[model samples]
Target: MLIARWIFDIDTIDGRSAADVQGAAPAVVLDESVRVVPGRDGEALAFDGRAQAVIPAAPQLVLSQVFGFALAFFVNVTAPPDGEWRGLLYKPVGENDARGVGMWLYPDAMRVRGQVFTAKGPDYVDSRTSLRVGEWTHVAFVADADGMYLYIDGRLDVGVPLEHEVVPPYGPIYLGGQPDRPGFTGLLDDLRVYASALDAGTVQALARPPS
Candidate 1:
């Protein structure tokens, strides 16, 4: 089940709260840098490559201490200009590590990175797929006992197995951008996070625009 879904359809902003259409959690608009822009479905949050909105790691937003998790969103990239990694959705993987187990955009590919503490084994895994610019694209990432998967526009493009034990992350989830990386220079809409890994069919269905 999805603990929260931020559709960003409403323009109402009471203080720092950004309502979650799924009726679970509200993201605190950090620094008031993000704005609500008319998006693919209705409305979306726009980050100016500076600020980010964050949903705190409340009990409801935290996933179970398991490897199963999934995230999906609709994005339209207007300009990436630089090759700097831009975060789409992220959760701090470790306190010491600068990177996280989350989705990031490269110059041409979108990557999902994750790692587990280990002296040996498949502790680090990543999935990547090329991305198209100037249009709305549906992206999805799933990590579970089966491994990590990345989907673009609902199409399964990358999948890898988790060969070692990995602890789940309980840190706050950031959308639009991460702490160290640049915010997305575009619009984001219909963001969702599920506690369980979704199958290919389910992910494809989710990619369909609201009708």
Candidate 2:
């Protein structure tokens, strides 16, 4: 089931808040640097490597058995020389423990990567190939009892075995940036969170352009 969705179709983050289409609490914008601009569908939220939005923690946001998320993103420019990592989506468990699921862009490589942390260890997967700059791409990351899967443009890119089941990260969802990590320097739209992992057919349907 779709738990949380942020379409970012509004012209502005009115009152510093963006509506969650699924009826969740509005996401609070972090700063003024974030802007609403043209997106693959309607409008997208732009992050200039400094701003972000936070969705308060809710019981439904926590997933243990199966879950996944998909988003449309367009990288505006390459990362600065000093940029090491920039977060696209992050939900952490603790400040010191490796217990979270996150997807980020390796700006320098222009590649997308996803990771999941469990009691056993962390599993990682990446697109292996670079994405074209200035173009919107649909990316999805799914975690199930079998393993973790990374899909780009609705196609399976890679999968990594989950040594241990995912430990639900109980925390607020951070979009486009994190408090400690570099913010994503790009446009993000159609962010969706699901309680169940999406299958290949459904993922393909999501990647299709809106009519």
The top-ranked prediction according to lDDT is 2
Query: Scored by Cα lDDT, where does model 2 land?
Result: 0.72
Top model by TM-score, which number? 2
Candidate 2 deviant stretches above 4 angstroms: 11-13, 25-30, 66-83, 94-99
Estimate, for each residue in 1-211, the C-alpha lDDT of model 1 and write its tens digit. 7877877766645566677766667565655788887888777788787768887766666553264778888888767447677767776644434334566676445444444332233355455555566688888877777567778888887776766655555577777667666866888888888888888999999988778
- Please report, in order, the local distance difference test score of every candidate based on alpha carbons: 0.69, 0.72
Tell me each candidate's TM-score: 0.84, 0.88
lDDT of 2 by residue, 70-133 (tens): 3333344334424477788887875444538888878577777888777777778887756666
lDDT of 1: 0.69
Runs with alpha carbons beyond 4 Å of true place in candidate 1: 64-67, 94-100, 107-128
| Model 2 TM-score on a 0 to 1 scale | 0.88
